[model samples]
Target: MDTVETLGKYEIKRTLGRGAMGVVYEGWDPSIQRHVAIKTVPLTDVDDPETQEQIARFRREAQAAGRLTHENIVPVYDYGETANVAYIVMEYVEGPTLDSLMKNQERFGLPEILRIMKDLLAGLEFSHERGVVHRDIKPANLMLTSNDRAKSRVKIADFGIARIESSSMTQAGTMIGTPTYMSPEQFMAETVDSRTDIYSSGVLLYQLLTGERPYEGGLSAIMHKVLHTEPLWPSQLSVTSPPALDAVVKKAMAKRPNERFATAAAFSEALIAAASASAAVVSPPPEDATIIESRRPVAGPVAQPVSVPVATPPKRSMTPILAGVVVVLLAGAGGAFFLLRPSADVPRPTPSPTVTTPAPIPAPAPAPVAKPEPVPPATVAPVPVVPRNEAVAPAAKPAVSPAMISDMFAQITATQRCAFIGGSVGNNSEAVLTGIAGPGARDDIRQTIASHAVPGTMQWNVANADTVFCPALTLLQSIAPPFGSADPVLALTLADNRTTLHDGDHIRPRLTMPNFVGYLRVDYIAHDGTVQHLYPQVADSSGAVADKVHEFVPGQKVSLGDPSAGQPGWEVAPPFGTDMIIAVASSRPLFTRPRSTNVETAATYLRDLDAAVHAVRDGGGTLVGNALLVDALAK
Candidate 1:
């Protein structure tokens, strides 16, 4: 790899990091006399369709972040291209990612965790309000910077996977998030809202308190646990944990989106309350009783509504009335007795005592000694024994033959099996399936497969796909036609009518656009994730002069005249796989600038293209395009 000293106005000091998308460098922006982190991916790598889409998405989110003015979010300052390399310049903060910090520290103290959660949720609330969803909010993407006055500040980084609420950039049914941090809905590949972030924040909080992730396993196992298993209470794992915190965790991680906190603000509020209650007698609420949610049936029969019986107040007792009457009579009798007794109480009597002594003792012990008899010889009859009843054993179920089990599995419908590909049963009835495609009732699928494989001996394992997979977008996302008319179509042809090409092979891309005269920009994403502006590079490599934006007329054909003509023709390069060539045409000028040395400089150009396409549908102007997929060298 060649080390470059400069990219646009910035001096690349050294490489900071590199990933599948591109490389990040510590750079010095000479114009501003400030340090910056510059990220760039070479044009040669962007040629592959996957790489193109990925890099494009990365730039798109950078542009989105550039629009935000939040202190908690990593800021995007500038975007440009130089020497066929696209670069995004961002604020260079000196800090370690939370992931790195967590490695050295076990569980964060309550104060530390509270501060982090508050700052994190604040960033999330700001981003969510602005309609930007940071689909990936893992610990690694959070930067913790220390300030002189404040303990630490959390900055959310890496908006490469973020999506604007209004933009449908992500195709439907695509799963785009880290599975461990993903919400149940995300795992199901269902539509996600900001509550998805709440669930992730809950997982993050859980980890901070317990020093372990809520779910840990292989991809499929993780997915299963995230979807179904409730995390162990933090108090159970960490002795220092406050019991009151469990309610907050339960609310944030409620399996259903509606069950989770309504907003990041709400989640933050709960955390603050729990932290403040550290000293009080906090019998906050029963976990289930806190929210008082209406009861819903869960894997049980629906209970019929019952009318509560009303009770009448008890009648006053009559025993007290009878007791009062008896007391009055007794009192009257005592008064009469007292009046009669006074007259005869004057006389009393006296008595005397006498004493006497007499008696002789006689001895007669010998007579009774011989009367003892031998009456112990009588035998008692044994009681008839009664037998005890024993429990009856249940009959054994008939064993299912291996052939019958195989046929049962064969009978499962493709839909019932969902995206399971090929399957086979081993001698011991261990069934292995090639892969599972989308999310579905995995438990049911396993049961169905087992029923047909070897009922009792059956075991299931996923082969190709270890986790649920989302379908890739194959069709070009293009502008719809105006006024119900057919969209302007563009087609590409290889000189040899072959989709695969080798290095040093020159191929002419024949062009078509919306049949009307309009501005056209022809671009190709190379396999290395580089964006190549093919046409109108006649006089300079940066781009064409202002007037050369192509205009299309019906039945007008465009082509690369010969291999010798460098402009509008592509010579295949190395490190090739799949590449996509797209032609965008709109009635308005798409590029605000005349030249883009690389794709980062072209982001605004692409963004304007998308806006134009959308604008045309709303009766503003016309925009349309077509895409061609070509295979370059395998490696």
Candidate 2:
């Protein structure tokens, strides 16, 4: 090997680090006036088929990572090749890799651990949605950057073995990943997906929580454990670990892919939920119960008792009629005893004191009584009891009249290009108007709506549009008025209950059909000018069902894009701005013909949707729709 000074336009300054296959150098890009990291792999023998394949893979790294645009992902700036070497130029991230930190015995608090996982999952969600699966997800590839607020920001690097879903570069049955973090399926040489990354992330999380990897040993040992054994729960290893966190790790590292979280978003949500649960104080067991003490096993031969609580039955009072019957029977028995006084004298001789343990008394069954009249149902439904330490859904806000909100929204749409007003309206009116607009337009829209509606009802979630989203603003304005009202028959909300999101954020849309029973369809209108079908992913396969309608019953809540359900959630990506998710419930199928593709131009989708809405209306079929606007910003 010879000393190299440069590769293409990147001036190689000095060596930064060395890997198995290549050396990374801190380089300077003159044209961009910025620092870059140059990774160069030597071409020892170009004619060798193996070398040629390696070159292809090296280029594929650039292609796979280059397609992704996210704050948590280290972006590829350029790719070039010399006669004897090939190189990739990427953003120069100045920070320590998570692997290095861990090796140095650096400790991570719960907040820091969560932040790292959030950023890592966010990056994976973005890349996975774009059809790239990072086969190798390890601490070595995660770099930590400090933000202006001195918070750690994670950036994922080294997509060398990342497999693009649409590409056939990597063949199936090729075992290519770190054995320590490889998922069970990966070890079996099976096809991998986003869940593979999830498993690896779980391993990283386990390490973070317990200061040790779930499986540690030689290759064969790790493989056997990952395939057939379950690691000790996080709580078992670390006393400070919460039981909820143990559940999260177990599910994330489930042997089967289907058992794991369906999407990175769901995994992230579970982590947040676990944190919340761990923070909550656990309630004590009820009184009138016998409880045995048990303790979690530690690394010793000490024996501990298993804890089990037994409930005591409540005592019941005898009814007046039953008590009178018992009294009459006792009086009859006393009279018989008086008649047989000789029998009592014979028993007195055998009355020697004998001590014995009394048999345990069994609880008596209640005597049946005459049936009483049925009671009418209560006006308000009784709240169902939730077990201690379990999550409780927030109570739904009081319903508001849609007509008032609709009229107020109509006034705001007269001028603003990217404006959407949603929420409820009434004495307890609460609405949020979100979109991309300038300061003047936002103020004007807010002021106009605030005057007509309640002063505090309107919440403005507006942001200035960047160059990428400027054109989308015009398109949004041209679209027809959103269907349904502030109070919709089918309600939709983000699973995390957040309206403001950032790059790599997961979008889990939850739908509730409280008072409606019909087929449902959900479409995501993105800031990138594309409308993607989010529900009933495809038409009926056998054509047995004409409408391909997915039926939704009243009082049922559906979490769309949940990976645990074998569906991927929508992940926020580039062209950050405002986006809308439209949900429609119809008595019949809205579109009889199957769509050629799930995604189409916004104009085409709206045109089709408008026709469908009108057709349903003309046919006198029940139809309802609702829209939720979210602001997607750069992290």
TM-score of each: 0.45, 0.45
Candidate 2 matches the true fold with a TM-score of: 0.45
Q: What tens digits encode model 2's per-residue C-alpha lDDT throughout 1-635?
A: 23777678878788999877778999999997999999989988888997887788899999999999899999999998888778999999888889988999766656678888999999999998899999899999998875331476999998988999888877676878999899988877778889999999999998887676776544543554577557667654443355689999999999999999999989999998898777432222222211111111101100000111111111111110100000000000000000001121111111112111112233223211101113231121112222222233222222324444433344344234333222223453444443334335555655544433322354444434433333333322222223123222444455444556676555655544535456667766666667667655553344321223445555344444432211223466666666666666666677887677677777777667666755664455655444555667778
- Model 1 RMSD in angstroms: 41.4
Query: Each model's RMSD to truth, in Å?
Result: 41.4, 30.8
* Model 1 misplaced stretches (Cα beyond 4 Å): 147-150, 280-635
When summed lDDT is taken over every stretch of 10 residues in candidate 1, the lowest stretch is 326-335
The CA lDDT of each predicted structure is 0.51, 0.57
Per-residue lDDT for 341-449 in model 1, tens only? 1112212211111101111123112111011122221111212211111121222223444443333333231223223222434555443332222344345555544
Please give the lDDT score for candidate 2. Answer: 0.57
